[model samples]
Target: MTSLPEDSPPLIRDNDRDTAVGRLQEAYAEGHISHEELDERLHQVLTAKTRGGLQSALASLPEEDAGTTSTIAVAGGRIKRRGAWRVPRILKVESAYGTVRLDLSRAVIEHPVVDIELQLGTGGAKITVPRDAIVEFEDLQTGWKDTRYKTRRRPRSGGPRIRISGTMGFGRLKIRHARR
Candidate 1:
């Protein structure tokens, strides 16, 4: 039921959303839309599959004032935070090796999940998860590099569930230092 304003900036299209994003960039450069507005509208532009679909797309983006905060910060990376709901701590990451430092961690836990996304633009990335939790996972992309995390020995008790997903565009995903 949500609709774009009659005067809303003509609207953006899926194929043209990129161009619209560029215009938004110009708008920001000219001090038209605030950073917050740009971030929000950008979300709409990306989520929208088509020009007409943009109205709803833009509307669905999480507002700064909204309870939840979701953003895609990098050139080819998007970080979406959904529901601080529950669970110890969950970090879903999508990036290349250049952001590997952001991926490494030294922690032990009963239940922990580290979701990693690798792109061809990436290299040497690994995730460290506690060995206490049960391990249950599936390969998103079939390949040797994607199994880097599977190299670790799973704990005997129900086996900690560790899920590692990879794509041809990415390098390798290794799960290391999983404390038992």
Candidate 2:
């Protein structure tokens, strides 16, 4: 049998297509692209067969804000965020004697990578990440309780990468992916 041509383009996967679509949606939501442009780009992303084609579809979109950071600190109370919130590129959360809950399932995440630094003392934390998110907590240090997380062996391709690091003292940290 004859060998295949070397010039053939690399095929694109479903997850890659989903990622492009997400970027397009974000650009549209941020007013970087008009409705018509979003439609056109979305169509291109849906029909693209190769990585180059996908890149072309995402061309000219504004880059995400990579320098933005937000901090949430509580000395003796609960800190919670959920429901359509805007997620910054870097987030620092500190709790001295209360619980911290962060629900990112419905949040608008503009960046592809997000960093979360947690410092907890005598309080627990429950973090619900987006369904497609890839979580990394290798740099976290625990005191009395080990973090509760069901690690994914094969992370999805199109979701944001959440990097979590910091210290937890005498409190448990529970992390789960969103169901919906």
Give the top-scoring candidate (lDDT). 2
1-180: candidate 2 lDDT, tens digit per residue: 997699988889765786688788888988999999999989988989899999999888877445689999888999999999999989999888999999989999978878899998998899999888988898999999999999766677788988899999989989999888
lDDT of 1 by residue, 67-150 (tens): 222222344443222222222323334443243433223333223233434343554444554444433346456444545544
Off by over 4 Å in 2: 1-65
Q: Each candidate: RMSD to true structure?
A: 15.3, 7.9
TM-score of candidate 1 against the unseen true structure: 0.37
Cα-based TM-score, every candidate:
0.37, 0.64
Worst 10 residues of 1 by lDDT: 64-73
Q: lDDT for each of the candidates?
A: 0.46, 0.88
